[model samples]
Target: MDAQLIAFTGVSAGLVAMPGADFTVVVRNALVSRRAGIACALGIGAGLLVHVALAVVGITAVLAAVPALFRALQVVGGVYVLYLGVQTLRQPHSPVGNPQGGPTARPLRQGFVTNALNPKVSVTFVSVLPQFVPAGAPALPRTLLLALIMVAVALVWFQVVALLVDRLGRWLRRPRVARGVTAVTGAALTVFGSALLAGPLRALLRAL
Candidate 1:
C-alpha cells in the first residue's frame, strides 16, 4: 500500500533470508544432501506462510491494545534471533534422513519443522510486518496478501540458491577446504544472530 511499507518488507525479507542463519541452513542442507536441501528450502517457504498468518493475528491483537506492545515484541525477537545465531556453531549436521543428494529421499516433515521452529521467522512476521502494514488496512486480507508476497520472495530466491549450490557441488567437495567451510558456516550463523541481537540490545539499553 505505502511505498515505505513495501521497502521495509523488502529490506526485512532480504536481511532475514540473506547469508545469516537461514541462508546457512539452506546451504548446509544443499551441500550435504540434495533432496534435503530442496526439502529445507521448501520448509523455509512453508514456515513463512505459517509465520505470516500468526503475525497477522498477533499484530492485529496488539494493535487493538497497547501501542508499546510492538516494541516489546522487537526486544524479544532480537533475543530469539541471537539465540539462533549461537546455535549455528553447534548447528546440527545431520543429513535429513535423505539419501545423499538423491531424488528418492525427501524429509518434508523435517524440513518443515526446521524452518517452522526458527524464532527469526516469528520475528519477521511479528516485529517486521507491523512496521510496514499501514494501520487500519483491511487487516486480514491485506496481511494475507503481504504474507504471500513474502512467501513468493522466499521460494524464488531460495530455490535458485539451492540450484546454484547443486551446480557447484564438486567445488564444495574440494579436499583442502571442506572442513574449513563447515567451521566458517557455523561461525557465520553465530555472527548473524549476534548482529541481530545487537540492535535490540541497544534499544533495550536506551530504554533504560
Candidate 2:
C-alpha cells in the first residue's frame, strides 16, 4: 500500500507540474493579482473535487463508455476554451494598483469553468485512478484516498505557482509586459482549444 501510494503521488505530482490550461489560467490571473491567482487555484481545487466525485460515482465511466456523449463534451469544452482565449485577447489594460480592476471571484469562476469543462481531466480521473487501487481492497475508500491526494498535489502546486508569479508582480504589472504575457497565454489557450476540437474530428474522419 505504501509503495502504491508513493507511486501514485509521484505520478500526480508530475501531472500537476505539466503546463496546461490550468497553469496558463493560474499564471494569467496571478499576473493580475495575488488574490485573483489564489482564488483561481482554489477554484481549480474545487473543480478537481468535482471530477473526483464524478469518477468515484462512475459518471465518468458512463461518459467514457458512450462515445457520442464524450465527443459532445469535448466539443463544448473546446468552444468554451476558445471563447476564453478570445476574451483574454480582447481584455483592455487596467491601471496598475487599481483596486477596482475587477471582482476577484471572476478568476475563481474562470478556473472552475476551465477545469470542469476539460474532457482531458475526466479522462485522467477515469483512466489513472484505477491503476493504483489494490486488487482486493475496498475500491471506494481507496479510490477516494487517491483522488484526494491528486487534488492536494494539484492545489499545492498551483498555489506555489501563483505565489511565485505574484513575486514577479512588479515587473509583470507593467502595461507592456502584462499585455505581452496576456497575448502569449491567450494564444496558447486558443491553440489548445483548437487541438481539442480537432483531435476528435480527426479520429472520426480516420475511422470513416
- TM-scores of all candidate predictions against the true structure: 0.64, 0.91
Of the candidates shown, which would achieve the greatest lDDT relative to the real structure? 2
Q: Pick the candidate with the highest TM-score.
A: 2
Give per-residue lDDT, candidate 1, residue 74: 44
Error of 2 at 112 (Å): 0.5
Show where candidate 1 strays beyond 4 Å: 1-9, 59-111, 134-136, 190-208
**Clashing pairs in model 1, backbone N/Cα/C closer than 3 A:** 34-101
For model 1, residues 52-86, the per-residue Cα lDDT tens digits are 76676674355335535544554454454455445
Off by over 4 Å in 2: 92-102, 203-208
C-alpha positional error of residue 56 in candidate 1 after TM-score superposition, expressed in Å:
2.7
Q: RMSD (Cα, Å) of candidate 1?
A: 5.8
lDDT scores in order: 0.61, 0.85
Worst lDDT run of 10 residues, candidate 1, spans 90-99
